[model samples]
Target: MRPAIIRKPAEQSVTPNWDDSAAARAAFSWQAQAGELCGLPGGGLNLAYEAVDRHAQGRRRQHVALRLLDRNGGRCDISYARLSSLSNRFANVLKGLGVQPGERLFVLCGRGLELYLGVLGGLKLGCVVCPLFSAFGPEPIETRLRIGEGSVLLTSEALYRRKVAGIRERLPQLRQVLLYEDNGGAVDTPPGTLSLAQLLAEASDDFAITPTTADTPALLHFTSGTTGTPKGALHVHGAALTHLVTGKYALDLHPDDIYWCSADPGWVTGTSYGILAPLLLGVTSVVDSGEFDAERWYSILETQGVSVWYTAPTAIRMLMKAGAELARRHRFPRLRFIASVGEPLNPEAVWWGQDVLGLPIHDNWWQTETGGIMLANTLAMPIKPGSMGKPLPGVEAAIVSRDEQGGLILLGDETVGELALKQPWPALFRGYLGQEERYRRCFVGDWYLSGDLARRDADGYYWFVGRSDDVIKSAGHLIGPFEVESALLEHPAVAEAAVIGLPDALLGETVKAFVSLKSGIEPSAALHDELLGHGRKRLGAAVAPKALAFLPDLPRTRSGKLMRRLLKARELGLPEGDTSTLENPR
Candidate 1:
């Protein structure tokens, strides 16, 4: 397929906030950009102080910071001044509980006012705030709590009973569990837990933000491994600089823009963008405390006047499955920008956004270790559908292969190799918790090995191939599963697809795809042959799937990422390690 270019109209194009490539290199190096982010008056820097308190004390105090939508179709607006007082009170509550600085504070609750207060408050108190998915089962919850050695946990009564109560006894380091009543603060607390509302009532609404250096750790995010325990990526307060820059240029955020990031705070994107980025940029963010519903999402986008939307590819594909006619029922006259992360966005989704949503879905790439957006299709640039655009101003990206001496050998453009970045970026993770050697192995001299296979086009756009481990070697050809999957999705009947490599005596490994069809489409022998022919026509016999299986649904993470590794493990009858993050574990 030819590259699909989505060009911005002259009137709609935004003037990028950051300096141009040449000017940026001359004026603002990574260190120079780091100096621009807000620091405390005395000396040190703090994430909460920069995100909330500063805005509260400034002219934007009356500006709405958060617009929270409840399940009952009600709304609550929180201003910077009000949020500042609330977070200050929550910080005071932490102090009253004898929770010291540098302690781990984990939040296991849905999106709500309390969740926001807890996160900002924990950061203000200098605690390492970690947010877990509310849907995680007991085992995953226990593993994170154990690894993080959580000193405090904030949750609702319902989540506590369903997920955390059974594992509470095993977490010896957990000092307290603060429960928020679900029934409008009318419920009684369980024997071992304390009431969060009552504590807040007793606490004063004034507390000083902790003075900390840019290097002080502020967040602990746990990322799943295919094997072994989850790795905890530690990030510092200085990451705010990366968040500010990326939010400004990549998302095209403006002070008057009303933005919505549909990612849950449990994941890294949710925390980095959903909470930190929008707030740091001083934009009004809409937060929905509900699950994925096509109608509800469109309603939020339409009614809230959301100008910029950052979401996942899975959610976008799900919306595509619902048909474009459903989206035509509403109008978003104010919406101007759409961006996707968490996984690579297929080319079809990008065109769908342009056709249905009146904009192209700009795809960006980053990782848990990177902590913020490293590469993106910024607002000022023309987007090549399915391409992760050029690296951000301060980010230096390269495609490199391993040398015989275990050092990195940079590859030229249009060559497929491991994607590596020259580090010292502000948002880079400090280290994996207690895994010094494991963390050190991620770097080769000055380059941080991304462990992703990609190629840079002659035009400078970066295209995602597949995970290094997911590359299939077949008949002297290295095939990326994403290419095969993208080809399969181009078929009209296909709704979702996952590709893997199966052992073959002749080719060493052959491509196999598991696909789910669109609604009202029946699986027939003719349709199967048609899909096979489509793949062959698009990708050729060397890279096309040799076999295809139809399924009702594909296993994905809660964050909407397809589990290709799990599919392969199940097909080969191998042990499926760490099924904790699987959306549907069977």
Candidate 2:
């Protein structure tokens, strides 16, 4: 929120080309060069080739493409050459199965090498790739299959049985199902399923990459809607280029940096950071295939020599509770930066990270519609606590007016309102697939209105308040959930907390909190009253929770977003839909 901090000297080494905006824009992506910027191109460049083949052609094949650690603790170091060949073989497998270009290929695998290849392979074949979380159950999986109209489903043998087995009969468009893991005992494959290994063995590992434009549909990411069905967010090849640019600035990922982004690949963060950004830049990124353990995560940094580390605020908070001494023994001399997305990184977490991790944690913000990071604190920029920093160079972010009609209107400086983008960048989604009306509603005139509420200081730094839906209203006064949650987090006993609005006959809706206590803390009536008293003293009674439920954990998305809607649904005894994204729904 202060005056713009001058770029640090070290930041210059990782800066993107700013020579000619016209030339940089011209070289945005294959789709832009192919004429998709003005109108749809007849042929487009494949993003897979752009990320893999283009790097290979430029003699960057020797660079480490991926450093993968399996669930069983096995390690695999893959280069550009290996990644390209693997993708080719996978593309050939799809080709042999009669899967044509422009068809849909759905991938349902966890973090690892196979998931990477399947995604790139589908893109190389000019097919739309839909990546789903491995934790999703049959209902969520079925919803995607119905909407995606997937021609082929690729998954590990474990997830295939646990999730897809029961729903395979209902998916009419799913022609082929390929299992990546080698299961000696064959499970039922619905008559059309085939062995993925066998198919790849029969096909040549030299499938030709398809040529396309930047506008070609490369990805179909589904976002959960408050209404009926989930909407499919359509992204083109041009949007993929943003990852390469974002990686350099936001994440500070370099060739020697053993970067690790804790975000799962199923979410937008995973797609952007976990895969595309690192690969495009030829960085040696670490893939932690196992579960999250405070000691183990610290060990990975110490042992693997992770230079740039990125994770969520929730994980950082969890690590904070594990104490500083657990990491004191390790020497992470190579570690340079720490970054977070998912939610606003609390100032406390940022301070603790600097005190213990030797670097300040930078917070960034973006959405599913934006293919890459829009607002961020770059390595070159000076640290600003509790701010989402300025809009990235190519992005134009602004604060607009919230009118009486409950719609976004244009606003000037220092005013709090809805955040909107003045122009669509290369990474921005074209539209919601098959929902023209809904897509049209997202844009207000020239501005693309993001549903988040924020305020910009006189210096242009954007400060996040909360999501519009999560805003609390009481007695004609408006309050943000972050303000209240941040207050609650200050209490030593409160490990985590989520605030939501509940129906109140007197005040339309009153604030209610579901709290999780720190380790060894018990739920006591005295403690509840103490927390309420603390809230009254710290944040005023107007923002205090009217009712509090001490829970073990909050229902959150895999990306670590508190799912207040799900909690509200449960409190009202309403049927909760597609909690597939929920990490701990109970």
Candidate 3:
């Protein structure tokens, strides 16, 4: 099948000769296609085969592929040889259960050996895999099952009995349920359910992998929308090639580097960096299959000699709260790089990382549709504190001004406007699965509308402002919510905050803040004054919140991202649209 990404305008543009090394050049070369440079060829390869089988074929069979740490301090060191065999056996088990190629299969489990094997097995058989976060309740799970038309569910018996048992009646497409346990008793299989081990025992590991081309849809990643219902973003095999290029060049991943991405496999970050990127670079991936603790994470960095660490800004802030003395005592001798995603890192977080961890947390930016990191701070370049840095080589970005006439005018240096990509890279998603019209509208003229607002400096650095739809229009002043939110977070009493534009009698739309206070902090009229005063002092009176409401917690998605739209919906008493994307909505 021809690549569907070719339809994007970004895939039809001219590329510049960015002076890079031979390895970088070759990786970048694979990203170009259809008279445009976007993605690479996977050598007709499956990520599971490349990550496990290819590594095991050579003399380096004993090399450790995964280091899994359990909740009780137990550690399991898995070799590439064992991983290949286990994955192959599991693939046979899937086939025995009557699952076919081109079928949609869902895996709802935590980050462990079983989760990895299940995902790999499904891919090897040419089934599109949809991985959901284990933390999600039955509502979100059922929504995914219905939307995906899932044929089978690979989950723990405990979770099946608790979450899936009640919702099974709603999912008609679900034909079978497989448990990931050894204890096979007279437990209720719900008519068609079966045991995972029993099926594997009857099947053979000698089965051949199904032939899948680059254009075949490989993954169906549901974006955790902070506003509306989650949209499943479809990614193809060709997009995998771009993921390799991005991880290698943009993140500057090295083969010898022991990479640890602390993102859950449920989100896009997990798929892009945790699974695809590390495997493509042929690096040893460290997996901590347990809850995150500050000291434990630091210990992982010190004990494992992890060279590269990729995490979210929220995690960095949590570490900063633990104080720098603990970080000073930790010896991360092998750690050369640390990167942050999800949101642009605050200047304080960046400073704290450099001071405590001996490395600055380089901030990068991208969305679920973009596939991987489209903008990042390369190791060879100087680190900028708050900027998301320039566009990755082969990816084109611009800040275009939209006038009253709805014309998109490209903005010059130091000017703020809507951030849009001029070309589609290999990692770009084909379209929103089953939502063609909604996907088509995201592109304006020949560029993809990123919905983000940004400004480019004369030196080519792009600074993130906020989202276009979220921009606040007060009186005649246009304000980005991020600026005000960041200003409010700088205060000592504030743990987290969300700013939105509300209908006003005089100012047209006034800024309103819904804040979550820090521990031991009391929410009163005085604390409200203090928070607003802090914002006014830093961001000027124009962007300061006109009103403040104290909440115990902010509405967030299953992935721990704040959902400002939900708060807005509550404040206005408007009907909240599909909130399936949120873990806990107001």
lDDT by residue (401-424, candidate 3, tens digit) is 777887789989988898899756
After superposition, candidate 3 runs with Cα above 4 Å error: 1-28, 31-43, 182-191, 402-407, 583-586
* Model 1 per-residue lDDT tens digits across residues 451-536: 99999999788999999989999999999888888889888899999899999999999999999999899898998899989999
Give the poorly placed runs of model 2, Cα more than 4 Å off: 1-44, 182-190, 225-227, 402-408
For model 2 the local lDDT of residue 180 reads: 69
Could you tell me the TM-score of candidate 1? 0.98
Provide backbone clash counts, one per model: 0, 7, 8
lDDT of 2 at 266: 79
**In model 1, which regions exceed 4 Å deviation?**
9-14, 18-21, 24-26
Please write out the lDDT profile of model 2 over residues 1-586, one tens digit for every residue.
1233344565444443332244553455434333312221234556777677666655778777788876566777888888888899999888877889889899998887778888999988889899888888888889888888988998888888889988988998888899866333444444567777677768787877776677888898887534357788888877756787788767777666789988888777887788888877777778878888998888888878888898998899888777788878778877777899988876667777777887778889988888788898777667677788777767778888767985667677766688888666777888886799989988876788888888888767788877888787887767777767777887888888888888888887888888889887999999999888887888888878888889998887777887877888889898887676667757
**TM-scores for every predicted model:** 0.98, 0.90, 0.89
Assess each prediction's global lDDT (C-alpha) against the native. Answer: 0.90, 0.78, 0.76
Q: Residue 493's C-alpha lDDT in candidate 1?
A: 99
